[model samples]
Structures are given as structure tokens and as C-alpha cells.
Target: MKLSGIFSDGMVLQRNAQVILRGQCSVGGQTVQVVFREVITCTDADPSGNWEVQLEELAPGGPDELVITAGEEKLVLRDVLVGDVWVLAGQSNMELPVRRTLDRLAEEVRGLDLPMIRQFVVPQSYDFHGPRENLDSGAWVPATPEGLLGFSAAGFFFAKKIYERYGVPIGLIQTAVGGTPIEAWISEPTLRRIGGYEATLEQCKDDAYVQSTKQRDEDRNGQWYARLNEADTGLREGWHQAEGEAAGWSEFEVPGSWAGSELESLRGAVWFRKEIDVPVKMTVGEVQLALGTIVDADDTYVNGVLVGNTGYMYPPRRYTVPQGVLKPGKNTLAVRVITTHNTGSFVRDMPYKLKAGGQELDLRGPWKYRVGAVTEALEPQTFFHYMPAGNFNGMIAPLRRFPIAGVLWYQGESNTGQPAGYADRFQAMIQDWRETWGIGEFPVIAVQLANFGPEGEQYTDWAELREEQRKGLAVPRSALATAIDLGEYNDLHPQDKKTLGERLALSARRLAYGETELVASGPMFARMERQGDALRLHFTEVGGGLTTRDGNALQGFSVYGPDGTFVPAQAFIDGDTVVVRQEQLNPPVHVRYAWSNNPAKANLYNREGLAALPFTTEA
Candidate 1:
């Protein structure tokens, strides 16, 4: 008898719930016998050669052996345990491996030796034909330095907390893909119920369109890169200054996107240069140059010397120049920004300075921009994995039989594009999964979107997205991990995953295990009461009452009057409620807090050290 890999040795069965063991046989109507501690079960294989047997709940300790027999084909599984199982699902933030965060969590990772905490990572795959029933292959692994390195950082830390607290085997099933939207995770049927995704779902089903598009993109990318390589002006004209500058370089605004200002619909390598007058005193030693941020990718140079290279747009641009690379009179900084796609440039509202010998130079305002080579537009990548129902078919469908405690989801960054009506779609997805699992109201803890993006007056996209996540509270047994205070201005993959994991466990403690007294979340804006000229905002889940993370005045509050214009408002704490008011506005129609893309310093948190989520009273 061939069995599913999850039913192999070293796997953990869910405690206090029926555990379903499954596999297949070549012959139909075969008798499948499963033997476990305090339980023995038998079942007949279906006509299609599929068989599954459910065992009664077992206690939380094990190093036990499990035996199964199907028509004289005997199999034995060793070192099995009974305990809580949780599925951690999301995008890159959820797929970030422990090794990626080793710089920060090294000390934490070294302490891991818990064999009780096992993990099973669903191999990343996508399917459009139909929802798949069985995974190709995967094996359960113990929590070790080598093993944990492949596991999700957030999931590992969360499992460590749960295993330590409960002293039970914890099974973490990590099924996530980076840069994927929520629609990709939901099943086709679920997407059908959610309307707006119908078009996307239908397109996913079109085999001709999918294959043709893929081929076209592949051919186009091959041509563009091949052509650019042959006629790279950046190399021919001595652009790197490190590689070497061309004459008459065009001028463009520094710390801004080049697509809108300097180059429109531009792709490929573009060289940037700025002349800085270094003082004689500061030139005695090496200096660190901060270029703020660059889009797509970049190779930076100082006085024609290679300093550093940064790939991608999310990280800040900081390169170190050698001591000899700088001179007293005039210093040249050349950066070759390589954006594979369209819309490339240096981002604004970031640190752009050169520091040396206790002296600093601001590298902002004007910089000469020149085209290295304008490559043909690269076709958008066909993300079959991000297509509707694709991930669920390949990753989630096989886990329908394994019972789980609950789900800890750290997604929604992919869904921010359609924040206005995501609540219904997300809720529909929750219901569909619950229905598929045949479990009633299993708890779900979703992390709210963290602060991000450049400085802007209005943050309609992400703010509305946070509101949708909050609106998920309308569902039963759901909690949210508000990460408003945890995001870095330049980095999308923030390194403070420990707090996020701990926070997720806090909610799981209350929802999944009935530890109801635990203050698992930050203050949530429950309702507002208009008192005189001010609005008194009441909150929910404020453990030990509300207080700012940094002990100071309340900030991030804004009020809009009858004219529907939002203005910064003065806010202060009063008992458990926060009273907000602005001198210029009266009879406030709406109030919002931390309602921007990157509310860099929006320090509104509860005494529990959890950041209060962004919210708006409007609609």
C-alpha cells in the first residue's frame, strides 16, 4: 500500500480531535486497518483506490509507533506524537526562512532543539486544471538549526512559543508563496462567490491564453536582454566611472521616481551622477554614502570606484566608499540603476547623505541622469501561482483530512490593490476553507498591514486594506495582529518577526486554547462618541488600559468637519477613552488615526506594547 508522505514517521497527530490518515491502493474495496494508541480503526478503499481512516482523539504525549495494513501490505511509522497543529499561510513575509533573519534571530535560533515542534513545508506549486487531492511528496522534520533554516521564521518562532507554553508537540504546516495575492490562495468555488474575482478566475481556466501569454513573455524577455547585452551604452561609454560617464548626461531630480520626471516609459540601465564638493578636512578618511533608495536595482560607484550594489526597490541605498576613493576638491558619484521593468528611479523621504570625519554632505535635489541603454519593455511575468485557486489546488487541498488547531495568516500585502471590497472576498475565503475542512468556526488570526510607502497626504489604498482586515472581526473566532508600529520605512520584509510571532501566539492562546484572560491584542477602535466639540473614541481589547508605546502625548489623530477636510487634531488620554479635538474644526463628521502609507512616527499603542491599528471613521 502506498500512503501519503504526511502519514510517515515523525509526524504529529492533532490532539483532542479526530485525526484522519489517508493513502491509496491499486485495488478497490481493500480493507485498510490503522492502529494507534487507545484507538484502532478500519475502512474500505473507494472505487478509485482512495482510502482514509479517522482515529479518536488521543492525549498530548507520544514517541509511539503507528501500524497500518492494507491487504497484507504492512507499514510502520515511528516516533509519532499527538498535539496541536497549526497552518501558517501567507506571502513572502510568511515564507521568509529562519536563515534570512539569522542576523537578528541568531541567539534565538541557537536555543532550538525541540523535537516536539515539527514542521511540514508544502512545496510551492500551482495548478489550473483542478484542485489537487494529493501532494507529490513532503516529510515532517524536527526543530533543529538545520531543519528550522528551511522553515518559516515567523512560523518557527510562533511554534516555539506554543510548544514551550503547552509542553505538547506542535505541528506547523507552512504553505505560502511570496509576492502572491489572496485570490491565488482561495479555491475557484470561493472566488466565484466573491464576484470581482470572477474575471480573474475565468482567465485562469483559459488554457490557450495562459500558455500563449507565457510563451510570449518568455520570447520577449529573451530578445530584450539579448539585444541590450550587445549594445549596452553604459559599458561602452564608461558609465560605472567604476566600469567608467558619457558626455552631456541629462539632469533629473534626485530622490524621486525617474519615470514621471526624467524618463517616461523607460526600462534597462540608466546612469546617475552627482558632483559633491568634499571638504579637505573630511577627505582624510573613508566615508559612508547614503543614496536614500533606488527602484528595481542599482550598482553604485564613488569616484569611479565600485562601492556597493543593491538589488530590488524595498531596501535603503547605503554604500561605503574606500578612503582613497574620495578627494578634497570634487568627488563624483555614479549609480547605474537597472530596472528590469518600467518606472525606475530613486525614492524620496529617505536618508541621502555622505558622512566622513564628523562631517556630512546632503546628497539631494539635482542629479544628472543619462540613459545607459533603453531595453525593450519586458513583458509582465505570468504568475500562474498568483492565479485564482492555483495555490489551493497544489498546496492546501491535500491537508483537508489533517485536523488543525487553527490558522495563523500573515497576508494582505498582496491584496492591498483592491482594498475597497476585500472584506467580502476575504470572509468568503474563510468560509470556504472552513467548509472544506468540515470544521465549525476554527479560530483565525490575521496580521494587519504594517506602515509602508513614501510620504503622502492620503493613504487610501493601505488604509482601506487595514479596515478590511479589521472588518474580518465580523467573522466568528477571529483576531488580528496589528503591526502598525513594526514596519520599516524602506524594507517591506521587516526583521522584527519575533514580535509578530509572539503577537500571533497571544491571539491563538485566547482563541484556540480558551486562555481568554490573556490580553492578546492592542487597542482597536470600537466606536466614537461625540462630546461637545470633540469626539471621544472608545476602544476594545485594551489590556491594562491604553498608553502610548513612547511615553508622550497622543498622536496620529485627525478630524474632519462638515467640509470633509481632514486636519491634524490634538488628542489626549482620558481614562480608557481618547478625546480628540482641533481648534479650527467643530462638529467633526469623521476621525482617523495613523491613516497614512508610512506614518513613520505614529506612536499610538496600548500599554501592552502593541501598536494600535490604522483606522478611519469615514465610511
Candidate 2:
């Protein structure tokens, strides 16, 4: 008898909901009995040898074993604990690892020894069909140093906070794919119901369409790799022969895009080689080479020894060069960069230096470069492929049988740029998942988008998308965690995940764990009243009172008079309310706080040292 893919030993079931047990049986087998806490439920197998049983709700606390008996065979699931279950879904920032954050990995890992916290990651997949009945493969593992490495960094931290406070076994089911669009995660039926995505889903379903897309991606990938090989060969040949054909080389900055520079908007593979002198003391030990960041992909070699390589552009610029690779003098550093789309070069603000032991080796001088190939048209590479029911079928459907308390989500970055349609799409996804699970008003908590980007640039659709996320809380039994002040401008993946996770747990504590005194959110804009020339803004969850994070004059507050012209306004804290007034305007109609691509130095905060949620009084 073969079991369904999702069934395995040591799996954590959702504690207080209807638990569905299912599997495959041999031919002619009529019945299967599922026993939990001495209760036996019998169900007959279908003609296809598939069987399912929906068990009654179990108590919250458990150290029980589930036994499924069929004829002469018995399968016992061990060490099952049930408390709360959550689904952590998001893009790259949520997927960013703790190890990437500078110097906090060891301490974070040592502190994250929660035995009751477990995580199950859905393998990346895409399907055009309806939801599948089972997952390809996945299992729940305890949250330890070894288990947490590949886990979603934000999700792990969020679960850790919940487990510490709740004292119950927490199950985290992660189903996020990096760089995936929101449409890809939505169910096909929901997309069709939404109407505009019919053609897109139809294209996804057709085998011919998939084949053509795959072919185009393959062709593009092959051409790019070929160009990279050619550049590497050319650099190797030129370096070996001591060639000095540097007359035609153009001068360019070390860490800026070549599109606006001398390279003149060329894409594909380009080879850059620079010669730097390594002191005698530097040659004996391992060296640190900071190439900053290169567009697309880059392979670096020190003295012809391949030292480091990066597959994508978003990772940091630091790379370790092995010891003995650097000679005493005239060490050669060759970098082969391949770009699938757009111009190629080292991105600005990235560090470019080579440090050996304690000495810094400057690598910011002019270098020689040559273009290997140029093509008018390039094929598109599909690193991520969308399939029918890929995630819903493989990841979520398999766990439908397990009873869970609720779901927590930290997604929407990928969907933020598409402001026009994300609200309905996100709401549809939540509804679909809830209906499919057949659970009754299971608690769902979501993390609101944090503040990001530069100051004073308010031409962002992200603000609208955030409003959409807030509106999602209107769904039954749903809550939102506001994180407006926890984000950094230059870095999309913030290292302050600890605070973000704790805040998320606080929301769960208040909404799901029956905690009443917890202030889970910062000040949220409740109402705005016009008082003469000033707009008096009222807020909720003002734990202590209204304050500024910077302890200075209120910044990030802007007011627009009836003329619709916005200007910087003087804002002051008046007890629980904030007053905003600009001298030029006799009447202010609208007010916006931290409204920009990046709200740098914006310091609105609650009395609890938490940043006030970003919002606007305008529609």
C-alpha cells in the first residue's frame, strides 16, 4: 500500500480544527480506520484506492500519537504537537536569510532554540491546473540552528516570538517563491473569476504555450552563457600573452552602470580585468575581495584562480578570496559579467576593495574591458516557471488534512508595484485558501508594508497597495501588523527582522491567543478633524501618547490646502492627537505622513517607541 506524499512521521497537525486523514490503499480494500485519542473513524476507499477521513476536533494541548490502521498494516505518526499553524508567504525580502545580515547570525541562532516551533517549506513549483491533492514532498522540522538556515528568515523570527510567548507547538507552513508575481500564487479559478487574467491563465494552461515559453527561455540562457564563455576565453588569452592593447579602452567609474557611461547602452557579457599590487605580507593569508555588486551574474578570478561567483544581482558585494591566490605583486583580478537584460556594470554604492589580514587593498582604479558579443534581440530567461496548481496543489493541499489554529502571512512586496489589481487578487487568495481548508473563521494575521526608499518622493503606488492590505483586515477573523517605521531606505531586506517578527507575534497574541492587554499595533490613523487652520489627526492604539521617533520637531508630515498643493507643515504632539498646520494655508484639506518612495528620517512614533503606521488623510 502506498501513502500520499504529505503523510510522514513527526508531522504536526493543526490542533483545534477538523483533521482530514487520507492515503492510498491496495485494490479491493474497503475500509481504513484512523485512531486519535482512542476514537476510531472508519471510511471506505474509493474505486481508485483513495481514502479520506475527517476527524472531529481535538483539544489544544497534546502529546498524542495518530494511528491509521488498514487491514493488516498500521502506520503510527509520532511526537505530534498541536497549537497554532500559520502560512508565511512573501517575496525575496521575506525569503532573505539571517546569515545575510551582518554579524547577527551567531547570536540570533543561539537565541532561537524553540523546540515547539516547527517549519515546513513548500518546494518551489508552478502548475496551471486546479489545486492538487498532495505535495511533491515536504516535512516539518524543529526550529534549530541546522533547521533554521534554509527557513524563511522573517518567518522563523516571527514563529520564534509566538512560541516564546504562547508556550504551544507552532507550525509554520511556508509557501513563498522569490521573484514570483502575485498572479502566479492565486488559484486559477480565482484568476478566472477575476476576469482580466483569463488569457494569462489560458496561456499558462496550454502545453504549447508552456513549450514555447520554455524554448524562448532556453535560447536566451544558452546565448548568454555562450557570451560569458567567450569573454572568459578572451580574458585568459590576453592575460597569458602580456598584451597591452589598452589604447582604445574607455575610462569609466568603478561602481556605476555602464549604460549611461562610455559603454553606451550595451548588454550581454563584458570582461573587466584590473591589475593591483599585493604587498608581501598580503600574499600569505586569505583575502577579502569586495566587488560591490555587479548586474546579473559575475565570476571573479584572482591571479587566474576562480575565487568567487554570484548568480544574481541582489546579493551583497562581499566575496572571500582564498589564501595563496594572491601573489606578492602585480596580482590580476578578472571579472566576467553576464547580463540577460539591461546594461551591465557594478551598481553604485557598493564597496570595491581587497583586504588581506588587516590591510586594505584599493581596487577602484581604471580597468581594461572588452565586449565579447552584441545582439539586437535577446531571448528571455525563465528562472521561475508558473505551473497550474503548483503551490496550492503541491504545498497547501497536502496539508489540508492537518488541523491548524490559524494562518499568518507576511507577503505583498511582489504585488506592491501592481497597485491597480492587487487588492482584489490578495483578498481572493485569502478567501480561496480559507474555503479550501474548510475551517471556521481561522485567525489570519498579515504584516503591513514597512517604510522604504528615499525622502520626499511621493510618486509611489506602494502607498495605495498598503491601503489595500489594510482593507484586507476587514475579512472575517483577520488582523494586520503595522511596520511603517521598521524599514531601511537603501536595503529592501531589513536586518531588523527581530522587531518585525515580535510585532507579528504580538498581533497573534491579541487576536488569536486571547490576550487583551497587549498593544499589538502602533498608532493607526482613525479620524481627522479640521480645527480652524490646523488639521487635528486622531489615532488609535496610542499606547502611551503621540511622540516622534527622533525626539525632535515632527517630520514627514505634509498638508495640502483646498488648492491641492502640498507643502511641508509644522506638526506638534498635543496629548493623544497630532496637530498639523502650515502658515500659508488658512484651511488644510488633506494630510500625508511618510508619503514617499523612501521616507528617510520620518520620525512619527507611538508612545511605546513604535513607529506610527504610515497613512494619509486624503482618499
Candidate 3:
């Protein structure tokens, strides 16, 4: 007999709730018994060799053992605890680990030990067949200085904060996948009821179609990279070596894109070299190289020795320089960047330096660069894992029997382009998840999309999606965490997950823990009234009353008239309302606040220091 993959040593069962123990016997018609805390439950294995024993409700706190017996076989699980288990779900933002946040929270996280905080990371898997009965692999790991690096940043902080306030052990089930959309996490039945995804799901369900698409993508990309490598002059000439340095390399500014530059249109390999002067004291201890973020892929080398390589873009380029890699004097830093697309550039507004102990060496400014090879832009590949019901089948479905306190959702960037139906779809998915677990109206703490993109861009898709997320609050026992002011304009994966997690914890306090008096949400738009050419907007949840974040004049407000053209409007606080006026917009019909992709000027906040949610009066 063998227990489910989720049941093992160091596992944490839900506290103050009836826990279901499930396993598969070696043969059918066998008696399976589960003994936990001296409470015995027995059941017979069905024809499929599957058996389940539902245990009575358990209280918090444990270092207990769970014993399961099937016929003559016996299994013992050690170091099990009864705690509050929360499912962390969504896309890359939720999947991003604590190690990525160390660049900003290193001092706070270093040497920290919290054994009560544990996590079972669900392996990245997808299946179009049906819901899985068991996870292929998973294990519970407690928070330690070493183990904490792999824990989800948002989930960890949320757990830490919740534990601090409630004094309950926290167990996190990480089921998030990077770059996946909400549709991927919804069940097949849910997707069918939601409709419009039939064609996509049908194509994905076919084994032949899936295999053919994978083969085609592999062939196309394999040939392109192979050809580019063969033609790369840098590799042929050994440009990574100090002795192989060649002349005629053009000078370019660091921390900037290649657009409008000498290598603007190049769509292949490019070699960049920079020389840095290092001190003996700085090279003595641990040394780290921070290249911020790079476009596409990159293989970085220091002193002719490869330090690190990232396959794709989006991840910050942080590499550890070996003790002997940096010398007392001049050291060579070389990077071979591979751009599948023509847009090869170093991202701006990120760290670009090398650090040793407390000393530093700035690797920014000018760098010598040369084109290695040129090729056509690689075609975009399809991700079968993002199809509807795949992740639900492989990642989420197996955990239905496992009880959870609630869910922490931090997605929606992938579906921003089609924001119109997001509200209905999000609500439907929430209901589906609750029904799947047989948990009635469990609290769901959903994060609104953070502010993003260039300031000059006029895209309102993100804003519209935020409104859709707000609409999701119509569901019972749900809360929305606003992240409008927490994002960087240049980076999609923001590093400040601590604040966002704190916001999620606040939501959990009110929605899940029954903290009725707590102000957990930001100011929400309630109603609007038009007075001639100006509009007065009222808001709810104005904890300690509404105010500006920066103590300056209220901004990010706009007015629109019959022409449907929004113009910048002057706004100021009047009692509990915000009055917006645009002289040119006569008989204004609508008003909006923080309606752009990156509404940098949006500073409205409350006394509790939470930014107001983005909204449009037209809704």
C-alpha cells in the first residue's frame, strides 16, 4: 500500500477541520486503517484499490505521527503538524521565489528561521486527459535559511505575516506556474460551462496535434539556434578569452536597449565586454555580479570563466563571482547575448554592478560590443501547458481531498489583452475552485495587476483588467489586493513582493479570520455624480478617510464628455469625495482615476497607507 504523494514526512494537515486520508491499497477488497492522534478510522479498498478514511476535526499544533495500514502493509508518516494550509495559485508573480527578492530583502531574510512555515511545491505538470488522482511528486519543506530560498516570495511573506498575527502554523501548497493564464487553472467542466474555449481545448486534447506542434517548434528553434551558433564570429574567434580580444568593437551605453543603436536590427548573437578594476579587499570574500535584467538570453563570463547563463528574458541577471575569479587589478567581464527576436537590449532602472562584501564596483556606463551573427526573428512557440484544464488536471485536481484555508491568486497579466470577459470568468473560476474542494465560499485573496509599461504608452488594457478584478469582489468572502503603486514601469516581475504579501495577509485577516473591524481593502469607487462640467466621485472602505499618498495635490484623474475623449482634469479632495474638473470637457459624462497602464502620477491613498483602486466611472 502507498499513500498519496502529498502525504509524507513533515506534512501539515489542516487545523480545526476534518482531514481526509486517502491512499491506494496493493489489492482490492482490503481493509485500510488510518490512526492519527489515537483516533482510528477504517475503510475497505474499492475495486480500483483506492481507499479513503476521513478523520475527525483536528486542533492546531502537532509533532505527531500518522500511521496507515492496509492488509499486512503499514506506512508511518513522521513530523506531521496540524496547521492552516493555503493554496498559492496564479502565474509568474505568484511562482517567483524568495531568492529573487533577496536583492532587496537580503538583510531581512538572512539567517531567519521559522519552522512553523512550510511549503509543498507542486511540480510543473499539465495533462489534457482528466483530473489526476495523485501528484507525480511533492514534499513538505519547512522555512530555514537554506530552504527558504526556494519558497514563493509572496506566499512566504503571506504565511509569515499570517502566522505572526494568528499564531497558527502555516502550510503553503504552491500550485502556480509562470506565464500561465487563468483558463489553464480552471477545470474542464468549468471551462465548458464558461464556453468560448472549446476549439482551443479540442486541439490540445489531441495527442497527435500536441506532438506535431511540439516537434515543429523544436525543429524550427533547433535549426535557428544551431545555424546562429555556427555563424557566430565571437565563438569561432574565442572572443571570451582575454588573449582573443579583437579591435573594431563599438562603444555603447549600458543599462539601455539596442533600439536606434548600431546593432538595432540584429537578431542573433552579440558579444559585450567590459573591463573593471577590482581591489584586493573587495575580492577577498563573497563576490556577486549584478547585471540587472537583459533582453532575451545571455551567457556571462568573468576573467574568461563562465559565471552564469539565463535561457530567456524576464529574470534578473544575478551571478556569483567565484573567490578567485576577481583579481586585485583589472578583470575582464564578457557576455554573449542571444536574441531570438530583434530587440536586444539591457533593461534600464535595474542594478548594474559587482559587489564583494560591503565594497562595490560599478559595471555600468560604456561597454565594447560587437555583433556575433545575424538571423531572422524566431517564430513564437505555442505553450500547450497554457491550454484550458491542463494545469487543473495535473496541478490542482489532485489536491481536492486536501483541505485549504483559502487561495492566494496573483495572475491576470496574461489575459490583459482580452479584459472584457475577465470578471465573469474570474468569478466562475473562483466558484469552480470552491466547488471542487467542497469548501463553501472560502476566502480568496486576489491581487490586482500592478502598474506597468512605458509612461508614454496609452494602453488601458491593464486598467480595464484591474476593474475586472475589482468586479471579482462581488463574490462572497473575497478580497482584492491593490498593487498599482508597487510595480516598476520597466520590469514585469516586480521585486517588492513583501508589501504585496502584507496586503494579502491583511485581506486574509478580514475575509478569512473574521477580523470584521479591520480595514483590509483599499478605497473602492462607489458612485459618481456630474455637476455641470465637473464630476464628484465617492468611495467606500475609506479607512481613516481618503488622502493623497504623497501629501501633494490629488492627481491621475481625468474627465470625458460626449466625444469619449479623456482629458487631464484637476482634482482635489472635498470631505469624503474627489471632485474632478476639466474646463474643455463640457457636460462631462465620465471620470477616471489611475486609468493608464503605468499611472505614475496616481497618488491617492488612505490614512492606512493603501493606494486606491483604479477605476472608471463609465463602468
In terms of TM-score, the best-performing candidate is: 3
lDDT of 2 by residue, 416-521 (tens): 6777666677678778778777766677778777777665566676677677776666677777776677776545666677777888777778878889787778
Give the range where candidate 3 is weakest over 10 consecutive residues by summed lDDT.
238-247
Q: TM-score order of candidates, best first?
A: 3, 2, 1
Candidate 3, residue 255: Cα displacement in angstroms equals: 1.4
lDDT of 3 by residue, 1-619 (tens): 7776888888889987778888888889988888888988889999888988887779998889999888788999999999899999999999999999888888868888998899999888899989888886789999988799999999999999999988878999999988888899998888999898899888888999999999999999999999999999999988887665548998888988999976788899999999888878988888899998998999999988999999899999999988787888888899999999758889998999998869888888999998999989999898977889999999988999999999999999999988998988889989988998996888999999999999747989999999899988888888999999999998898879999999999999988898989988788999998787678899988889889988999999888888988888999988888989987778888888899999998999889999999998875
**Model 2 TM-score, all chains together:** 0.88
Model 2 has how many clashing residue pairs?
Answer: 13
Question: Going through the candidates in order, what is the number of backbone clashes in each?
Answer: 5, 13, 0
Consecutive 10-residue window with the lowest summed lDDT within model 2: 238-247
Predictions ranked by lDDT, top down? 3, 1, 2
Most accurate candidate by lDDT: 3
Question: Which regions of candidate 3 fall more than 4 Å away from where they truly are?
Answer: none
Task: Return the TM-score for each candidate structure.
Answer: 0.82, 0.88, 0.98
Angstrom error of the Cα, residue 510, model 1: value is: 0.5
